[model samples]
Target: MIALHCDGSLTADRASYGGLIRDATGAAILAYVGKGEENSVLGMELMAILRGIMLCIQNDLRRVSIRSDSKLAVDILNGEVGCPWAMQVLKGRIISLCEQLHSKEIRHVWREMNQAADFIAAIDTGDGESIFNPSEFPLELVELIQNDADCKAYFRTSSF
Candidate 1:
C-alpha cells in the first residue's frame, strides 16, 4: 500500500500545498509542491489533497492511504461534513479523483506527524512555480524527511 501525507501553507500574499508519497516501509517515492492564489487555509488544504490524489493517479497507484493535518479538509473529503461554498469545486474534483482509484483512504493526522509535508508547503519559492518530482529533496526538508522516516515526533506552535 502507498502512504501519502499532504499539507498546505498560506500567507498574506501566497498559498502553497505539498505532499509526500511513500511506500509501505516509508521510503519516499514522490514529493510535490504547488502554488495557489491567496485563499482560505481550508482551500489550500483541499488543494494539497487534490494534488496528492493526482500524483497517485499519474503514477497508477490504486491501493493508497492519504493523511492530512487539516481535519476540516479530511472531514469534507470523507463526507463527514459539508464543504463551504468556496470549497465545493475542489471537493468535487477530489471526489472525482477518488472514483478513478481502485481504493483510497483519507484520514486526519496531527501536525507533529505531518512535519515533512508542512515543511515543503511552507517553502518560500519567491516565484509561483510548482515543483514536480525534484531530482533531490531540498536541503531544508532533509532533516524533516529523515525524522518522518524515523517516526520522530515534531513539536511546533500553530497560529491557527
Candidate 2:
C-alpha cells in the first residue's frame, strides 16, 4: 500500500498544497508542493489530494491510503458530509481518479501529526509546483519525515 499525507496552506492572497507519497514501509517515494490559484482553504486541501492522486496514477502506485488534516475534505470525499457547491468539480475529479486505483482509504489526521505536509505546503519555491525526491529533501524536511517514521510527536509553542 502507498500512504499519501497531504495538506494545504492559505493566506490573504495565496494558497498552496503539498503532500508526500510513501511506500508501505513509510519511506518517502516522492513529495510535492504546488501553488493553488484558488484562495479557499478547502479548495487548496482538495487540490492537494487531487495532486497526490495524480502522482500515484503517474507512478502506477495503487492501494492508496490518503491522510489529510482537512476533516471536511475527507468527509466530503468519503460521502459522510455534503460537499460545498464550489468544490463539486474538484471533488468529482478526485473521486473519479480514486476509482481508477485498486483500493483507497481517506482519513483525517491532526495538524501536528501532519507537520511534514504542512511545512511543504507553506513553502515558497518561486514556481508553480515542485517535486522532491528523498535525496533532494532539505534538512528540516528530512527531519520531519524521519520523526514521522519514528512516530515522534511535535508540539507548537508561541511567545506573545
Candidate 3:
C-alpha cells in the first residue's frame, strides 16, 4: 500500500510553499518540496499532490491514498464541482490526474496525518531573509524511514 500527504502556505509576498509526505508499508519513501514558481499557495499545494500521485503511479504503486490539509485541494480531488475562474484550470488538471492514476482507492487525509508536510512548508520566503535551510526538517527521522535498509528490514518481518 502507498499513501501521500501534503500542505501549502502562502505569504503576503510573491512566495508560495508546499511539501509532500509519502509512505509505503508504515514507512515513508520520500518527503520534499515544490515551490518558487509563479503559482498561488493553493496551486502549489495542489501541485504537490499531483507530483506525489504521479510518483506513485510511475512507481507502479497499488492501492494508494493521498492526504492533505487543504480542503480546497482535497475537495477538488474528490470530484467537487463549481470552481472559481482562478482555480478552474488547475481544478481540471487535478481531475485529469485523478483519472489517470486510477488506483483502487484514494483519500484526502486529515490535518494530523499531514503535519510533517505542513511543518516543512511553513518556511516564509515572503521576507527578504534567507536564513532557512530545508535539510533541517524531519532530519534523521525522515531519512531513516526513506532509507532502503529500513524498508527492507520493515517488510522482511511484516511480509506474510
Estimate TM-scores for all models.
Answer: 0.89, 0.94, 0.65
Which digits, one per residue and each the tens of the lDDT, describe model 1 over residues 37-136?
Answer: 6477988898888988898988998788989999999999898998888889899999998999898899899988888899888877666646545358
Report the number of backbone clashes for model 3. 0
Ranking by TM-score: 2, 1, 3
TM-score (C-alpha) between model 2 and the true structure: 0.94
Regions of model 1 farther than 4 Å from truth:
126-129, 132-135, 153-160
Identify the leading candidate in terms of lDDT: 2
Model 3 TM-score, 2 decimals: 0.65
Better of 1 and 3 by TM-score: 1
lDDT of 2 by residue, 1-89 (tens): 88999998999867899999999887999999998988799999999999999999999998999999999999999999999899999
Supply candidate 3's per-residue lDDT for 65.
Answer: 74
Q: Listing every candidate in turn, what is its Cα RMSD in Å to the true structure after a full C-alpha superposition? A: 2.7, 2.2, 8.9
| TM-score-best of 1 and 2 | 2
- The pairs that clash in candidate 2 are none
lDDT of 3 by residue, 1-160 (tens): 5666656666665444444445465555555554546467677677667666666666666456777777777776666745657777766766676676657344665555555667656655453222223355457445533453243332224366
Best TM-score goes to which candidate?
A: 2
Better of 2 and 3 by TM-score: 2
